[model samples]
Target: MTTDAVDAPSGRSASFTVLTTGYTLSTGPGVAATVSYVTDGGRHVVVDPGMVAHRDRILGPLAELGLTADRVTDVVLSHHHPDNTLNVGLFGEATVHDHKAEYRADQWLDRDADGHALTPSLRLIATPGHSPEDITLLAGTPDGVVAFVGDLWWRPNGPVEDPVSPDQAVLRASRERVLAVADVIVPGHGAPFRAADALL
Candidate 1:
């Protein structure tokens, strides 16, 4: 429900808004991945448009922001997990970005996510742990760098440990790397939080 913006050299501002704060039920089978909308000049990006309680949770917010799915120029997936990629086709007009490539229509472009700049203020960094294919989106805004991290911390208070991570040590390293630059973190299944408050 809030937007943050940062002015870029090209006189365009980069901005982002949490379209829907996602959630997961600890006691039952329920989960929704946090989805976000980001804009850098003419580029409109959607991050992790995955499973949600309802599609309105995603569309309604975009509509409120004066945008429609067709206007999204790009879609970034954090990993291949169903909870993080199930709704990707929702933005069919968008060129999809994942760990290793970009997909649009029938064209597939091979590229590494790490150090890749999607726009003047949005870049990707490799953060494999939750999944070997995991990547984090780094967005520059007035509030500082906000990282869209997939299940990196789950929540600010911490899952302390990620039970499903292929390598907990690697995950910890990834968390540290993000904390080094991100002032705020948009976790996969929770509202954003201050990076300093994140529990490893």
Candidate 2:
């Protein structure tokens, strides 16, 4: 996956820019780890670190932007999929907060890894349809709330697969949890959206 500078759509607040770390399976040409960074004072958060295949490429652009993994305060994973989490250990020093039920402590191991500390401000809303561990991170900001919804739904142009994992009920509940609070919906792959129509 290659990094690209996408122009923020009109009407969006100019304080932040959404940096796409290439496409992944869930997004087709649009699938990607949609990591967002606020250009100024807000906390530095990486929505999904993506797989090892695109790790260096993803971080390289951040370096050019004068940002490093160590500087990242939060690594929010939408789910427990390997593509979104395989490289999580790389950001050893940052607090790795995820869905409490989905989090596995052993996944944080590395030779020089700094243990992760979970934060309560960010709530892990259970959204399990795509996978049993799928959950969205509800991040509250002074402006509004941002929901990092992993594979809950793909990019509008991406393939539409049924989110049926035997845990469909849980997944539906998760979607509701996000719909209740998210002002901005940032999926695991593809672009971010502001309206409910954008989510479907």
TM-scores, all candidates, are: 0.91, 0.67
**How many clashes does each candidate structure show, in the order listed?**
0, 4
Give lDDT tens digits, candidate 1, residues 72-147. Answer: 9999999998988888888989999999999999999999988788876788888888889999988888667888
Give residue 192's error in model 1 in angstroms.
0.4
> Which ranges in model 1 have alpha carbons more than 4 Å from their true place?
1-12, 27-29
lDDT score for residue 85 of model 2: 71
Whole-model lDDT, candidate 1?
0.84
User: Looking at candidate 2, what is the lDDT of residue 64?
Assistant: 77
Quick one: how many clashes does candidate 1 have?
Answer: 0
For candidate 2, write residues 1-200 as lDDT tens digits.
11101111212222445565335654354335666554323456666676534666567767877888888766667667766776677676665656552223355432211112233234445567787666665555555666667778654342344454556556555566566666777766667777365433
The prediction achieving the highest TM-score against the true structure is 1
Q: Which pairs clash inside model 1?
A: none
Each candidate: RMSD: 5.0, 9.3
